[model samples]
Target: MTTQENVRRVLDWAVAEIGVPGIVAEVKDGDQTWFASAGVADIRTGAARRPGEYLHTGSSGKAFTAAVLLSLEAEGRLSLEDTVNTRLPGVLGTNGYDGDKITIRHLLSNTGGLFPTGLAPEVSHRYATRSGILEHRFDTFTTEELLRIAVSQPPVGAPGDRFEYANGGFHLAGAIIEKITGNTYAEEVDRRVIQPLGLTHTRVRPLDDTGYPAPHPRAYSTLFLKDGADPSTVTPENWESLMEEPGQPPLDVTEFNTSLAWSAGNVVSTTGDMIHFVDSMVTGSLLPPAQHRQLWTTVSTEGSYWMPHARYGLGMFEFDKQATGGRTLRGVGGSLWGTWFLAVGTPDDQHTIAVHTNTEWKSWDLMFKLIEAEFGVAIGA
Candidate 1:
């Protein structure tokens, strides 16, 4: 197939393999741009997905959170070395963890060693307010209550020992932002990044599925009524109605209510906005030169036995450099409520690609492969 045809086929395969209602992808290199969409936004209604439709970026939101925090540091409002207790007192104490011992750097780099609370479900239920979601609750507990839950749980490892990838660390980062800025985390994010970048389509508010914006794809999930049922028997379907299903609860699928993952991962955005933000960061426009260097420095590796070539930066991932066919792509991947997003690119060239889908399938890998072949460069793994 021709290069253009190869790109089209990769996108087509992604939509088909994931069983997504639709996908909107954007790619840019130098002065060139390419946009493509496949499948329906709402299969039942035959609606098509559009380029500007916002999707839940899941953990991919971490990059934005990290950027905001770095920007705050650059402004001399705070320091990465500041201990958590120095900013928010008596919060981490309930969890038996010393906030004073955990620095902002530790949180940003996922080296804090906090355990993941099974609180995503609980946070999803109690918090409807944007602030409330950033301050996720456990059994209706406030931010303080959730911190207590985290403290009560044993540490995954010693602070700053190694990377454990805890969402709680980011949540703490969000709380720190709130404590320092005296504003909602959403407000800080918007003022610092969203507004500055003019990302009109991106938002930190809860998604409204019923009255979803035009040309947006409906999310989907795989559900099984019986335990241990054949996984293959399950099928993907439009999850737009799932948000409103009575006796079914929306939090069941995503429990990111607390901003515990706030600085780690809680922002919602569009593919275009993500690519734009990434472009700005790599180009040293959003962050100071020194801090931006710290952001790209590898702090950990993400893959385990099942996936081998994934590495972790502050909040981003470094997939197989060789597999990407040699383009030094740096970005993040997030999954929430069966929705998935991947934003990636290189620094030297202006090349960047973002893929968003409603179903949480492995089809996103194809996006990197297509870009690799298109650019003919190896992204650092």
Candidate 2:
């Protein structure tokens, strides 16, 4: 069977079994590329999802922020060993936070012990619960506000102490990028990665911008309801309640202002663009030798907010023989509202898979199924 057909089978199963609104999977192996989708983009119109449509990529944008910083480092604009205080002194040291103790490398790998801002349960619950998203959906927030929210909470650990997945680290990274380059995080990313690579379809959603570019799927999200009240109890009328269930028909989040996610999770792109981006990242074509090697240097994340045996590098995850049986997979995975996207490939850049689902409620089986179907490699067996 063709790879497209095979991926369609999996997408079909994901829709039927997981009850998601839609799914899109793109595979790039050598010279061949496959794009497959199942389910609908709009529930009211029952519009079919198309291949070229962009979706909210959530924290996958973390990789972009990391790349921009690494590029700056390559030009001797900064150093990974530079402590946060050296560049943006006193910005993150308030409330028991010591910026001097946290290195850029620690921040990139999420070991800087800074409290998480966007990923904090309280921030997540605030939007998904009592207020729902309507109140804040259009609100624009500054990156420094996000940093303040994170530092208000006690530090999670000492610098380089643990492998917690914190969006605050990337936010800090973005802030530093701004300090050094005098350009916005999105601007740097565009100049360094998107424009250079000719990724015409990739874009960083602006803080004040709502809605997507033309020919994009409407994103849906239930925010952090997944860990709350039972799904069956959730009804359309009370969907905005704090006790609201997790997976009621997802609300249309397509046009929500992405500023709340800042430099951490506000990228939109197509599978084709993602494939090329992943290929570039895995091959070190966009990074200098020193930065490239630093990108792969990792620390154990087995007990962090990731799968078993997973290791974290600067801004991506590394799954090697232990995590992926015998092969290696390095990439980023992100979810926001009701959408999810994951892009991973081997160290040698021989194979790559980029998959997106319109609903974030799918189970872990979806990942293993995709890997097994695409690469014939059983992960977590």
Candidate 3:
């Protein structure tokens, strides 16, 4: 099939098999570009997903956070080797691990040895104030809050012992940015990254309810009761309508308050903007060549089978080789609420493929297939 036909085929299969309510995809290689969308944005209002719609980039936000930190380092405001305690004292308290032993590098590499808190609580003391909550729009967070959460929990292992993915580290990084710049995390992000990139559609808005712009898709999730009750049997129409309620309780639906997971997962963007950000990073427009290289260096494995060479570097996931068929692609994946995103590309090829969906069920597989078909190479499961 021709490339256009191939793209269409992939879109059809995605909607049919994955129950993807909406998708915004962008494929680019050198001078070539292809954009497409399928299904309705709001199944309730019969609103179709349109080109240029924005979706929450999720953990993909980490790449931007890392870039901001690297930029600060370039300015000589801080160094990655600085210990957490030096910048934010009494924050990590002495109860759990030695906060002084955990360096900024540990946090960035996910080797800080901080234990997991499962998923963060949807509401917290950190965002108790209206101003604090709104600050999430620009990535506001405090180092003290983040370190307390990290050190209060028992160690997953000794520092640098092994890779244990933790959002606490990134949250700490966000706080460090605030301390060094004397600016809120959001302001620093805008000055250092978003505004520089001319990314108009992207913002850190966590409490805003303006919804996505025109042609936007309303996000949905499959709700299952925590009490072991049967999953909600609501139809798609009802699901679409229910999303209109703001400040809805977490128990009511699959949507999550990502503000609680700031720095690590609190980013929102579009496929187009994401591709632009990656292109800039790989081409050395964002960071110095050396710093960019540092960002790609891997620290730990994501899992054994799926990601053999998968390592967390800075705020990004680096896949050295695919666990499936080894068609090389490197980028990031993020999940929030019921949404999922995958952005993959190779340095030598300049070919980037990004996919964002409004639902989480089997979303990763759907993104992998689209990448494989577009790049003409098979990827593992």
Maximum-lDDT candidate: 2
- Write the candidate numbers in order of decreasing TM-score: 2, 3, 1
Best by TM-score: 2
* lDDT of candidate 1 over 285-321, digit per residue (tens): 7788977887877654443211245656666766656
TM-score per model over all chains? 0.78, 0.91, 0.81
Q: Tell me the tens digit of each residue's lDDT in model 3 across 105-194.
A: 888888887755332332222232233334433343344555566555567778888887777778888888888889888888889899
lDDT of each: 0.64, 0.78, 0.67
Superposition-based RMSD of candidate 2 using all C-alpha atoms, in angstroms:
4.3
Candidate 2 residue-wise lDDT, 111-214, digit = tens: 99876564454465456542457677777778867777667667878998888777778888889999999988889999999999999999898778888776
Q: Which ten residues in a row have the lowest lDDT in candidate 2?
A: 230-239
Report lDDT (Cα) of residue 192, candidate 2. Answer: 98
- Looking at candidate 2, what is the lDDT of residue 250? 62
Cα lDDT of candidate 2 equals 0.78
Q: In candidate 3, which residue ranges exceed 4 Å CA deviation?
A: 120-147, 206-210, 223-226, 229-257, 302-309, 322-328, 361-363
Clashes of each: 16, 3, 3
